[model samples]
Target: MKPSIPPPPTQEDEALIKDYLLHRMLQTVLERDIQIFKTLELTMTNLYILNLQHIIKRMSDPYWTVKHQIRQRGIRIESKSWTPEGEIQVLYLCRGYQRSLLCSWPPMKEELKDRIISYLGTDLAAY
Candidate 1:
């Protein structure tokens, strides 16, 4: 028996893949999971899109290209909203950086925490 081999990616496809890989790396850093390097050896994709140091350059001012703007990657962003109780802080992290809305506020904070746990199946974790 022979193992299946993936077809070679075209130039255009390669470009798209590169762009995605870059964005993914940026996203991971935004999530604040600086421990990605420890798990790189276990992943299938060798692109190493899990490093903060590599993508940190993209977030730090004076480097972001028009294509990988902060708003575009959905990583490293903060928002404040006022509820009847107090202020609510909505933070979007890039660690793994799953581009989902992670909560850390008065109301949304607890809800977001629960949401993250439900999706990732971990409890009491944050960056």
Candidate 2:
């Protein structure tokens, strides 16, 4: 009798494992960053927690209401489904004051760019 060998993992299994690892790494990094941000007193940047609706529904918290922020005023949050490449539930730490300033003067492109850079510490094309 010949000995049989186990077949290699399927593509779906590999994809699922990849996603799980990515999410775990993202969570760890986000947690660390949150601690650092808190310790450094980075009040200018605010952490926006997205995907709260799913959590609320799962927990059956009917009283919980999520106040949606206007993305035009700050860095837009990316959807995990669309942004599978290292995308997570936590949004960037945006500067509230900068967002407000930008909203105050939407027509001024240069002013908006400068404000974003000042707050985010980098010039992002997304802004």
- Please tell me which predicted candidate would have the highest TM-score against the true structure: 2
Write the residue-wise lDDT of candidate 1 on 12-116 in tens digits: 332332333334434454455545544556654334343334445534442345335443533444343345545432333442232223223344345434433
lDDT of 1 at 52: 35
Evaluate candidate 2 by giving its C-alpha RMSD to the native, one decimal.
Answer: 19.0
lDDT score of residue 22 within candidate 1: 36
lDDT of 2: 0.34
The residue pairs in collision within model 1 are: 28-94, 30-94, 31-93, 31-94, 31-95, 94-97, 105-109
Backbone steric clashes in candidate 2, count: 0
| Candidate 2 runs further than 4 Å off | 1-8, 45-125
Please identify model 1 stretches exceeding 4 Å from their true place. 1-30, 35-104, 122-127
